[model samples]
Target: MLSQITPCLWFDGQADEAAKFYTSLFKDGKVTRTQYYGEAGKEIHGQEPGSVLTVEFELNGQNFVAMNGGPLFKFNEAISFQIECEDQEELNHYWQKLSDGGDPAKQQCGWLGDKYGVSWQVVPKVLGGMLSDPDTAKSQRAFTALMGMKKIDIAALKTAYEG
Candidate 1:
């Protein structure tokens, strides 16, 4: 059997809603399967008789599972999905969708709550190369530029580090 480890997002009785919202965000992905409480051959769950058990879905080629696992755990900024965009337009599209229930941090980056309190980062790939330059001078310049802004500006970072 093929096996893969996917991020299992825990939601407080809103797994279905979160799954639907996430499926709507990305064009390349869709909801694959969903298991509810009273479905065929389903295990018995307490309190909520016919609640959602798990939601299996994909977003931008990544697989994720959402569970109506009550309020045992919560999402924080400590973990986030980094979306590498080629340009501003792509970034804007992702940013707008991900930021639906989020509060903007500043510049181009922000912390999105998703419908499930999950956070994701919309970043530019160019920012990685600029920040990881072998030359300390270039790296420093990139860091300086990145520190001043919330949403990363790839063009400005390249100009500062390359020049």
Candidate 2:
């Protein structure tokens, strides 16, 4: 029942589907509600009476609400979910799933996208150490290694920082 902490997402007639897809991506998460507009509600965006208006779900212990907002807006790469992974295995799993349908963009550190146009970062915990390393050279190398990856190669990052 956490309030004031949920992400409200806008979808173009795909709120329900997006909710279902997001729930499937994370453990301990699922769609909790799908509310439809009724005849009493004014027709909006040509939505038929009784059409779904909102979808509520949870992912990775975070609550999300999606609305059929009539294509007024969309998700962009500007805002992203950052997953700090423990190791490369976890990073790969998340990278594969999230990038299944979206375009991949290589950035310094860890970042990518899913087919649904959602941005994500599968960062390794070790990255924090590297970025915070006392040695400026190692930190620069770590930054360079992060820049060369689309899906974060933890081993490469580690090697860069260590060497």
Candidate 3:
């Protein structure tokens, strides 16, 4: 059974597009369903009848829902999806794909904002181990090196930790 809790992403009439884009990026991803705005919500939502209202999708086996919630609210950096990559190649792949057309200024410390304003962190799986090492100096070094990078580099972090 699918998990009861799922992240609901807000979009300004781009739920379907965003869902499709995300699904294409992951191996186990797929759009499960899509719903359209109907006549009942016309007075309040102002969305054209039959326009996309919501899209349910899976990315890396995690379920999510994207809704065309209008422009009243905007996506901020407070919420972000974190992809724990197994290696540098995996991390680079996700970083490149997710950051395409995204704001370059927002690219820092493995975090980026996609063109649609959704924030994401493409990180190496070893990042947690490096950042939480029992040795404080090693952990600090790894943390410092990570902060200086746009995309997390596992080799750079290992060098910093060893130094």
Question: Model 1, range 1-163, lDDT digits (tens) per residue?
Answer: 9888799988888888888987887787799998777644445335355678999999888999989877778888778777888897887787777776675652244234454567777787787777787998999988887777666666777787876
Model 3, C-alpha of 69: deviation from truth (Å): 1.2
Q: What lDDT score belongs to each candidate, Candidate 1 first?
A: 0.76, 0.79, 0.93
Worst 10 residues of 3 by lDDT: 1-10
Can you give the TM-score per candidate against the true fold?
0.84, 0.88, 0.96
Which clashing pairs does model 2 show? 98-114, 101-115, 102-114, 102-115
List runs of model 1 lying over 4 Å from the truth.
1-3, 39-47, 105-115
Q: Alpha carbon lDDT of residue 143, candidate 3?
A: 91
What lDDT tens digits, residue by residue, belong to model 3 across residues 1-163? 7547899999998899999999999999999999999999699999999999999999877889999999999998999999999989889899999999998998999999999999999998888988888999999999999989998888988899899
lDDT of 2 by residue, 1-163 (tens): 8457777888777889878887886777799888997776464467777878999998877778988878677678789888888888888877777777777453335677666666778888888889888899999999888877777888888888988
Global CA lDDT computed for model 1? 0.76
Highest TM-score: give the candidate number: 3
Error of 3 at 137 (Å): 1.3
**Candidate scoring better on TM-score of 2 and 3:** 3
User: How would you order the candidates by TM-score, starting with the best?
Assistant: 3, 2, 1
Which stretch of 10 consecutive residues in model 2 shows the poorest summed lDDT? 104-113
Measured over all alpha carbons after superposition, the RMSD of each candidate to the real structure, in angstroms, is 3.1, 2.3, 1.5
